[model samples]
Target: MRRVPRWALLSSGCAPVVLTGGWVVAGRLEGGSYDPATQTISVLAADGAAGAWVMTAALVALGLCHLVTAWALRPAALPGRVALGCGGVAALVVALFPAPSSGGSLQHGSVAAVGFALLAVWPVLAFDPDGRAPWGLRRVPCFAATAVMGAGAVWFLIEIQGHGAIGAAERFVTFVQSVWPFMVVASCVRHKRPAESRL
Candidate 1:
């Protein structure tokens, strides 16, 4: 098994924090005007929004973090790493093409959809063919993770169509996506420690 460097934890771990913190702070900046239950995170990054800059910066950081994590995750399959990296790139593009203040932007929605799909599927793609992989990267676990993320995405889409808790749905899915990398990295590190000690 290839060793996963300890520093991968930092990059993967920061993803959820940056995303959650960005939305929280941005929501606060929007003050009474923003309803997180009904509005999406992209709204916070939209043009003329009070905390657009903060949200944009957070998104950019998230993208970089994913890119770094993908590069460091040597144990995962190459296709999985590429998908994760592409997801990161999608995030950067979403940031660059911020949503419109009053309505949806085709470019923004398309990029975000692609990012979500990539993030959701990357876990299964990362599954180890052999049975010796870490817990998080194992076939069953990876499949479970992908299933949950896919369900979350469905919920998000349903919410969007119904004009329901769009923000809540988005946050739930994105949070799962952001934290999954950390779980995989942690498992790899823990699995490595035992082997190292034996050696």
Candidate 2:
């Protein structure tokens, strides 16, 4: 039972909302083209420089989101904390990289890409009614979470081709890193029964 700071938890979830939201808004601004028709913002891409800053902000936002979501939901969560911690470390490693010496920069950008997968795995395995999950199911997500984070580590050490340890990804990697936050929100909703069960 780790004691989590309230600010840390709030910041974690809120950061992603702000960063990702900001990026989307920025896109809409440039094109004046938030398409209600397609329900997408920034139907067209922005400048490369703008895109880079948006992705960087997003990476930080998602990382903090994982930590915060965990804290907020820790009471009902299983052993998935290991996943959260390892995934966070993995994100730090990848994000810290000028990223990977050898391959395309995408391979080296671990923070958002790998981090998103790891965070998603947490809910897949550990979430349950009122945070009371079957022991086996709990283990499954934990392992998945660890594996996801570990994969990022591997990317850092081997795949990056031995360059500097920190870097950001191209857009694809950023998307990979960020997609899970939405899923996390969904999983929280899945706990609705549990929330009511307590009542």
Candidate 3:
């Protein structure tokens, strides 16, 4: 029942904006040849890319935002909060270990995968068994959201294996992941209660 702090709201709300804006700006800077449908965001931040700094800065900011949001999200369960924080850490690690322009980096891919899994699973871990849970934190919605993210991950993996729309799939999944925290915060704010209740 703890109300989400104003800072949490602001941080959560900015996540999607920063992430999407970063990609847009990076893509434009990289020129028309950069196909968002195929090329992944990491490419923009890869070594020797025109917008590498921009994308890297954005990613670092995004990771910090997630960390702040996780810290402020007191209504969620402890395990969920821990997972969310760890996901944020993974994001930071991803930024630290950027992939090469021509090839991949095992460390980067592993960290990205960890980040994705943590973000996707945090919702279910945060779900409250009690009926008083906020709408967004309810089991049905949380599970559905997690499922969609998982499916997106699968699609991304499939695209990676072939010359498919990896960029589009990644953008969709990451966007969803970025925006979900805002939804949960809003729900907490809306259903603000007097006591700290399980969520």
Candidate 4:
């Protein structure tokens, strides 16, 4: 297996922190006008929102982090890496096409859906065929990770349709997607072969 660069950990680890922190800070900036439980994070970045810039910046940073992580994750299959990188690009596009403050934007919604799908399926696509693959890249775990993300996506959609906790659902799924790359990097580092110990 090709070694995963040590710096991959930094990029992957920062993903979740940036995502969670972005929402929390942005929500606060929005004051009592925003109900996190009912509003999606995109609303925080929508036009005229109090913390639009902050959320937009966070989305950009998050996208860059994913792109960096994908580049450094040499141990994963090429298709998986490509998918991850594309997801990052999707994030960037979503930031560029922020939703309207008062209503939904088709472009923003489409880009976000694509990003979610890519992130959700990247785990399974990343599965290493080798029997000695790292725990995070093994077939079973990869499938499980994809399955969990898929289920989270479904829950988020249901919440969106029912006027439930859309923000909470989105946060849960996004956090899981962000943390997954970190977990994979950790597994790679922990199970590094002696020949690849330089990192």
lDDT of each: 0.93, 0.45, 0.88, 0.92
Candidate 1 per-residue lDDT over residues 94-173, each given as its tens digit: 99999998977999999999999999999989999878778988999999999999999999989978999999999999
Q: Which portions of model 2 show Cα errors greater than 4 Å?
A: 1-16, 25-48, 98-103, 106-113, 129-199
Compare candidates 2 and 4 on TM-score and give the better one.
4
Best by TM-score: 1
Q: Give the alpha carbon lDDT tens digit for every residue of 52-131 in model 2.
A: 34544554555566665555545335556556655655544544443322233554444445655665465454544433
**Best lDDT among the predictions, by candidate number:** 1
Please give the lDDT score for candidate 1.
0.93
Candidate 1 regions exceeding 4 Å error are 193-199
TM-scores of all predicted structures? 0.97, 0.45, 0.95, 0.96
Indicate the TM-score of model 1.
0.97
Q: Please give me the total number of clashing residue pairs in predicted model 2.
A: 12
Over 1-199, each residue of candidate 4 has an lDDT whose tens digit, in order, gives: 7878888999999999998899999999999989998899999999999999999999998999999999998889888888899999998999999999898899999999999999999998988999888889999989999999999999999998899999889988999999999999989878767566666
Per-candidate alpha-carbon RMSD to the true structure = 1.3, 9.3, 2.8, 2.0
User: Judged by lDDT relative to the true structure, which candidate is superior, 2 or 4?
Assistant: 4
> lDDT per residue, candidate 3, 63-182, as tens digits?
888899999988888788888888888878888989898888998889999999999999999888877878878889889989999999999999999979999999999999999988
> What is the alpha-carbon lDDT of model 3 when measured against the actual structure?
0.88
- lDDT agreement of model 4 with the native: 0.92
Please report, as a residue range, the 10-residue window in candidate 1 with the lowest summed lDDT: 188-197
Query: What is the lDDT, from 0 to 100, of the residue 52 in candidate 3?
Result: 87
lDDT at 90, model 1:
94
